[model samples]
Target: MDIEQLIALIDGFKQFPQIKRETTLFDIGSRGHFENPMTEVLSFFCNTTEVHGMNDLVISSIVSLIRQNAIYESLQYAQAHGKPQREVTTKNNKRIDLLLNSDEWVIAIESKVNHQQINPFDEYEAYVDSLIRTKKAVNKDNDLTDETEKQAVFVILSPDGKVDNVHLHPRWCGISFQQLVNEIKKRLQQHFFDAPFNKWYLVLKDFLLHLENLVNDEEQNSAQEEFVLTHLGEISQAWNLLKNTLQSVQQKAHTKLEQHPELNGILRSQKSSWFGLPTTILYSKDEMTEAVLFATGVPSVDIADDDPRNAGKHIFIQIHIQTDDEELELESIHESLANKAVNHWYSGGSKCFRWPVNELSIEGITKEFVSTFEAINNLSPLSLNK
Candidate 1:
């Protein structure tokens, strides 16, 4: 059992036929402007002062998600002018993604995509401190801290709502993107005939649809699972072969990475992971931007197998560029690479560049990937010859 044998087994599954569909105006606008579509929609939701009647639903829905029953009750009595702020900056220079402030309660949210927080409770605690200071400044005799304290909710909003348990606080809570989408859907179904907020409702509804497309793919997953189960015998054989292929790939890749100029000096333990599958991480000398050359065994091909060049399952070399800089957006970089790269690369899920591995031999494939890694490491924004 080897990579060649696994490729032979996977070749039996035919690629699905392409379906032609017209793109919508929203799709076009989203492609260009909505670099972080979730963040854009979230800003709209938190903007209570922009649309009348809609804010009530948005505020109440958010409160419910945060699991603050006391805050939800308090919000019912608050004035209509109480607005939620988006991307609220703290005194410590930490940004809260969404900050909802009312006389009786305050909710601070930190948003994440695929990664966990580096410091889970730092910004949230700072926001609470700021809230307490504001309360004291408003009234010298106010016993907000010692007595009659208002509610302060801290939330981490993510795709899976998973965060570091070590850095969690007693007040901290988690909510998934799916839960938020469901809450919005429930609100949309309820009868609210406010004529003035019709436009806002439609926009919010469209955003919910976008979210649905992103997270809700249960039907597709179930179909894929069913297909695999139907061919269990064949897949079992393939899986056995894949295990051997993975070991062979890891061994060869480790040896090559140890001798390569740009990607040398990596320990075998640091390069390979065993949890999901044996995947190897390759990198250049400069690791400042979290960019890397990742080589992993890709098991299946659905639409990519249409071309003769993409017919086999092998080790995939992905060039991933990542940054924590708030000002430097990688959307433009991803777009540039997708358009200009010699290979066919797609960028949507996260900032990464990759092309199909057409080379049949392991040594040839590894060398090709190493050269590409070096090329990326040597690139500069000021280079006129690029």
Candidate 2:
């Protein structure tokens, strides 16, 4: 497909409703460490002893979803007894992301966010086994044979309910963030208004929203990848065409400025310092003062689709004055053109002005540059320099 056809397709896609992903508190506060904050929040909510006041509601909902019979039963048994801990150290000193421990049950949870399950599962398993052994020995000493036998549950938690290699650890169970989110949503729908602690309820709701956003973001990214891959050929052709068109328009503008009678004696073409676009420099006879005109929205296109200069359709002429003379009043020169120019600002000891032209044609660029140059030269200090 050609550039125009691709652009038309993009326009057609724009007719479809766009889903704007929300920026949750977790997104702002996580600061790029998603898993650590996620584990911390999960541990906070999972602890029944905490002030959340829902007691075992959150943990029980999560535990009930475990598919493995042994892990499910062990977690169920420990629902009231388990105390959630973050960064629990294993027997081999390897740290599990989150752990829930009780007298007779040990639940090891490894949290994953955009990372493979390459952790020391064996060490974590050993740690849980050691904990169970210690508890069993203590029970034996206390003659507590009537109590249920000790057990250990290993879980790998990720965005998707899948592990790297299920065969590697046959006993480990995989749970997804989406599953936990769904379970919590179901519980919240029934008990949200009746929740004892309104503050904690809001927090749980926010965390659930965060998880939902994460899952949605992943799904959208997958969709975007599929779309790009399916249209790679057309997209590649359009991109090359855009670059070529930008270069062509820039060359035409440069040629027009270089050949213009009004700017012939003073105009010199050079690469712009900003974005490396073509620049037309007009200097005074003494060469002590110069006006630099830069054309933007070319090789580097504007991101806004509605912008006239987007995709090299139009040109934005940016003019800035440079002078070696300290006595020249740059602000006064900028003030003179303020009414006629679209924008005027001061930066780095120079006064800059911007003018938007409707088209990228050579005549439009040349006409705008000559008028702006004259406006600057008409000022008292600049006119004296010329």
Candidate 3:
């Protein structure tokens, strides 16, 4: 839709937070937790609109707007990009998504969604020394070449003459939507229309090797094998199908990331700035009222402050949690969720918060969460090196 329409849509949420007053002002028991009804409503409406086919993008946007950091990490380490080395995390059974390294480039990805296996141990580690180098020798600004250690932000754009110079790496050689498109375009120009017609042959060949491992795995079932075989075509076709799906997901995340521009956009106004923070909300009962009237789902929020029901601002936000596979929202699912939110608290225009609804986080770049980039950068395995 056009930008004005988009702005109007957001403004609609602002209006929703004030549709009704609470029946019991002084004590409505626990007003429950806080809920972010805007996205739920957007999600509900999106599922039913002419944009049905683009639902993933809309849903991802909703989730990404609420979960930027998680999206950033996912973009870096998704399996399609490279091999990943697993890490140790006490918070939960979190796993590193992917790891990619050449003599010149080393990347470690930490994904919050689609966390398949928690511990992808070393033989599980592809190319041991390479994994170590990708994880340990990344960019660190104050680095000295005395040891091979490098900084995390090092990119592959420029390479030092010395092959073993671990101190030298790409500075932000991270891929973006356009870069990916260019890469695919380059491959297509040279070989897509050629005899093999396997533009992804070189890249997907490796995945095919991995797929072979999958077939051989004792855990594999007949149904799974059949599914793989049925979808199998030229290696390039398979890769594209998967990449297209991911691209679709990635694009949707970008869209979702764009939703809360006023708040999330502020953290990342620059190219190199980092944006990272716990997705939050700040508003009054009127704001909450505005949110519910215009948004969808039973907005799930945590009550930050429970003061007098009649004379206090009720700030609300959606909770984010890192996990594998967010719940899918078919049109029906969104429709039901939207209806449910209305039926729950906002029935007579009363606003409320519910704890722990869907905890999803996106790893991204935005104005509000710009600080996150530095946080992740500091935590980056690349910067960890001396």
Candidate 4:
């Protein structure tokens, strides 16, 4: 597709309503590192003695979603033998994420976040097999009259109900986080007011919100995949064109930086760490300080207010000053450019300054870079060492 066609497609895409996911405590705490924390939370709620006060409700709802109906019935109707265990050791010392046991049933759960289902399923199955055999032996020794045989259920829980290596184990069953979330919601509706003042309820709510966010994110990604598949030809053409345009813009920016008279000796170009765009770097005399400028085609609304891109501004620039220089007063330099800068902060033992650019052209970017460079040099003539 042509540039105009690509622009029209982007414009049309932007017209769709934005659905913001609500931020939860789990979201903040996990920050995409969710596997262990999620397992702990699930184990807590699944335990009857936990403060969640919902007892077997959560675990029962989870079991109901499993493929084995007998196991769910046993766990839901009968009392679990003990508290749910986290990171339970298997026969080969492999740790299963969660383990729940009853007199007649043994359930082993392997939890996955973003990683593939590439665990020791054989070990897990063997562990469950050992447990079942031990249970049967004990029942026989005690001469228990109950005729029902012991059962083992192996579950692979992930964001999507998929097991990458299901062939490794015959008992492994797949369950989605979304399915568990839905089941828990259905069960919790009845117990919403059971403990009106319980803090664990709030914790459960937060955990559920986190799970919902993960499930929603997966669903949105699926929708995006569908969209890409539906418009593969147009999307491919547009992407190629966009990449070509960006390369052209980068070349122009580099030429402008090299051609600028004031930046004669100080100018160098490198790839930006932020967006991988071609960056124009102006080195100070000591070579410790650097003034970095780059142009991004990122849409305004996608940029954060405090971002180096200056949020809604079309141009992006940054100044880096080494902290080891005793003569360089970072605050003084920060203050001098405060009026022209969009934002300034300290990071990685270096002071950073961002200046606004209203124009979208290469010349506009070059002008801002030169202006900020001069401002810093004026503040501490010795800092840039230029």
Candidate 5:
């Protein structure tokens, strides 16, 4: 009924971890040959010449899914517009992932996973221009005059269902992996029981389930989610209490760490603003019992020891004691953090690397905070020397 109670229940369930064995083609292949499962699957679905007998079905299902999600007027406009083209060529020399083409209507899809930097709108706009140009060349009397009306639909397809360019482009829509799975299931249900698609249907189902898991970051039959969904009515009874308590606890822990006296003094003296916890905190061994800690900010951006102009030692270093279980905590720290810090710091960054804390107590966190101050004090006032 309470927030603590819900969290306790969730924590208890986590003990029985979901076993994610290599199941899907992409998952198993990813271990040996391929690196990205998302790319592999997308390519497979897009390639009609592949051994899979259902590329057309997959593409159509995706289009229908997007149409269902788009605005009612947009949907009506799209349906009334021209026939679907599998992958149309654009002026910018990029193939539109999926395209529907007619004299006055065009739909385009761009698929991605984990990638965020690309802005495909410019390329898409170029493609639309090419389409218009081609139409004019083919038919001299082409009556496609309504440029002001919605003529093109751009859909961004991703596992996470994120659409960053929708605000910039009014015609842009987003379709998530879950929505794709639901559409596939709906299409499958429409076929008769004794249909010839039984084998293909099973294959599609397996792949869809894999995509669903990939998006949600959970096993197909996630026990925790299943439990929560089934007991939503009961859980909703104390939802506010659970939500508020969890927020309060998290806020208190963060505030305590941020406002530690020693940390504040060290930050002010060094002319460095606190930038949250470092992914990895390394320490140099002091002759004293505690280790000298230093939060090596991301190595790529931060200046290292070898820099010729190491003036105004804005270096972030701290002193911290060992946690209750040093070995366990050490094992839990991300390997990349240690690797990057060592790589950036060169040689001296090695030796006494320790994770800051495990317990949420103020005493432990403050000790961790104070470790940085100790590290700063050891360095020469203007440079990182000794």
Candidate 6:
């Protein structure tokens, strides 16, 4: 269908529909106390760190309903600490609404609602440029010989028409609210076409008959209202069908991903024959810190030489929890132990010597962390097989 017809269909749902400038998004589904939803959606779209805001909720509700997606969150060892790198942010604001990160493969959505106006192309351009720069940088690091960009899906959540993919970049493509319902309609048509045409037509007719009952009640049947509500009723039916199809596909895809033979490797890796068993419990901060120390303690010792004779060797992980919250630190636990030790050491003398401790510089932490973890794995009884 033409863009105008799609825009008109969308306009029927909410205010701020068609604009002199097509970039203006309709404000339908606008009113609501949707802080949680927006925060969740913003975080989902950005795909890295957590985000929360009322505006984020508004954007998220629309994006989630129209686009079959959400932001992806991940946690990993970075610089010997759990540093949350927000994966994407849009550059449509004076201060970027999204941060595209070092690579364009991920997008980090950041927004400040205080701005008078947001530049339409700011996010689009930043996303493209981030991709280019990321490839070049990665290539530069890997030697100019391997400098090729990776492809990723491009998405825009707005009322505007899709950007000229050719004019912009090959990886860029988008859909608007106006286009979403039509896409669903097209899928219904495809399903009908694929079935025996007669059967499909009859099935579709039955579906519409059910829809007619929904809109045309025995009492309120004005001609104009019927004409309007009839389409709405059909849309509701189509939505239910689409939802089921999507859910089935999702279940199938997830099954493949989880049951794939390769996942066996990851499973084996995660649940290792270490000191005893896997330690993957969800714990509160205090409980988790205690658990990590307890878990780490469970790892049997390799070097037994502890007396003042040989090299007093000790292997321990530095619990580097890089928190933006200044209130928390690893030292509190250590210091508290030391304070308790003051009374015990006085009572017990040299029997319980303080533990040898060291801090790692953040600069070399990433390389060191990966290397140390690999070493820890090597020390693992599980690795003795290899």
Question: Pick by TM-score: which candidate is best?
Answer: 2
Per-residue lDDT of 182-223 in model 3, one digit per residue for the tens? Answer: 333354345445434433343333322322332233233444
How would you encode candidate 4's per-residue C-alpha lDDT over 261-349 as one tens digit per residue?
A: 56653455465434544455666666667887655557344345555546556446667877754444445764646566456667777
- Top-lDDT candidate index: 4
**Runs in model 5 lying further than 4 Å from the true structure:** 1-22, 31-56, 70-89, 100-105, 136-151, 192-194, 218-386
TM-score of each: 0.46, 0.72, 0.19, 0.71, 0.42, 0.21
Q: Could you tell which candidate, 5 or 6, scores higher by lDDT? A: 5
Model 2 scores a C-alpha lDDT of 0.63
Native-referenced Cα lDDT, model 1: 0.54
Superposing all C-alpha atoms, what RMSD in Å does each candidate have to the true structure?
Answer: 15.4, 6.6, 28.8, 6.4, 15.0, 30.6
In candidate 6, where is summed lDDT lowest over 10 consecutive residues?
Answer: 75-84
* Pairs in steric clash, model 2: none
Distance from true location, Cα of 129 in model 5, Å: 3.9
Query: Considering TM-score, where higher is better, how would the candidates rank from best to worst?
Result: 2, 4, 1, 5, 6, 3
lDDT score for residue 284 of model 3:
24
True-structure Cα RMSD, model 1? 15.4
Model 2 compared with the native: what TM-score? 0.72
Residue-level lDDT tens digits of model 1 in 311-361: 454445555554443333333543333332323333443345445656656
lDDT of 6 by residue, 224-274 (tens): 365468567555554455344333433332333234343342322121222
Candidate 6, lDDT over the whole model: 0.32
Task: List candidate 2 segments past 4 Å from native.
Answer: 1-17, 29-33, 67-77, 80-83, 136-148, 265-346, 350-386
Per-model lDDT: 0.54, 0.63, 0.28, 0.66, 0.48, 0.32
Residue range 1-386, candidate 2, lDDT tens digits? 66578878587555544568666667775443378888998888887778887776777666677644454653544444545767776556678888665544566788887777889888888776765666442222123221345557788877787778877887688888899888888887777577655688878888888887777777777777777787787767865665555455556545544454555435554544444444556655444345555544344433224333344433566666664444444457756455444455666665555556564555555555555555565622222111
Kindly report the root-mean-square deviation of model 4 from the true structure over all alpha carbons: 6.4
